[model samples]
Target: MAFKEFNCPSCGALLKLEYRFTETVICPFCQQSSHWTGENFEAKGEKVILADYGSKFSVGLQASFWGTKLGERKEYKFKVLGRVRFEYNDGFWDEWLLRVEGYEQNEYWLQEDEGEFFLFKKFDNLPSVNEYSELEVGMYVDWEDYKMFISEKAKAQISGGEGELPFRVIPGEQCDFVDGILLKEAIPVSIEYLPDNKKAFYVTIFNLDINDFVFTEKKQENVY
Candidate 1:
């Protein structure tokens, strides 16, 4: 990916956008968030979720994982692109947009709630989500070897978003998503199904340190 020289319209601070799959960016210096309007960057609003619902890993954080089923790469470094907060009736969760190194053609979303994690990769050829959108709990769905159980399902709205995102994800966009879990193994895995046309996705669990990816010394705000 290439870096594009630009300044945050909200703050006077100089910012650079990696011309990867992104449409919005937040200034690390001022916490000013803006949306990319294709031609120009327009100020959206100031990011507010930095304090409440803090994250272990901050946006702009860099990390690498080996043998990713999402990208089908053996090993690749990924940059934390953006963090979007979703609020349902029960509670809220955080979803992170990640950009693969050297590859801007695709983007991935890593959803995290508490210690539970789910990495979603969209596949067009996969079965339509509508076919099993109403899967009841206690029922199992086969995915290769593991039989994943429908854990929970609900609708959420994008409460807040900061940093660079894959597309225009402004506040107030409602999202319909579903979740599943596989308890067959000692370490249970999870799944998140989206109602998007070609947006069916699955997860691969991971646990990593925030210190390794975030520049905490320079940033005081929390972005999960």
Candidate 2:
């Protein structure tokens, strides 16, 4: 295990954190949220409580799952970080910030809605705002030679967050997106349009089956 220390640029508070691909943190002194830019931090905004606090899956829960990536067998230990609530139409969905381990990448997102659990990641190589702004719902895009379409094109907001994150997640950070769906698997594919093109994008998405996955609770251990 290794550790890293730095000063909060916002309040000059000594920011000591667990060093293992940490991208964002909230200062214990000023309570200001920041993004770790490799070596430095830029203040994003103040953090706020998410719109919905009670859910089946809360932040800081630990779970293990037999997930497949790149067509290989690997283990995944996920720690829930932040939970952002978005108001869409008369319904809503909670976006859980997950700090992932055992995977090649450091982090990803897990979302649970209705009776389905979704796994998603951000990918920036897609058609940009200007490129896809004119795109309408039900439009198809060639992806992996599989037919993908814009399913729900709407706006959302970062209702709140907890723990560390990699994006400027000031509560109420407006979000707009055009979601893609895979018809065969009824998969809610990845497609998030970051407001400032700052947060990461989504490229890969999967519908995790409970039978093929395992989950466990987090231990009462201090990561620090």
Candidate achieving the largest lDDT: 2
CA lDDT, candidate 2, residue 24: 65
Question: How do the predictions measure up, each by TM-score?
Answer: 0.65, 0.71
Q: RMSD, model 1, all Cα superposed?
A: 5.4
Q: Which residue pairs in candidate 1 collide?
A: none
Best by TM-score: 2
Q: Which stretches of candidate 1 lie over 4 Å from their true place?
A: 29-32, 45-47, 52-54, 65-76, 102-105, 124-127, 131-148, 182-200, 205-224
Each prediction's Cα RMSD?
A: 5.4, 5.2
User: Residue 118 of candidate 1: its Cα lDDT?
Assistant: 52
Q: List the residue pairs that clash in candidate 2.
A: 64-214, 121-202, 122-201, 122-202, 123-201, 123-202
Q: How far is candidate 2 from the true structure (C-alpha RMSD, Å)?
A: 5.2
Model 2 segments more than 4 A misplaced? 6-23, 27-31, 37-39, 68-75, 127-132, 183-186, 198-205, 209-215, 218-224
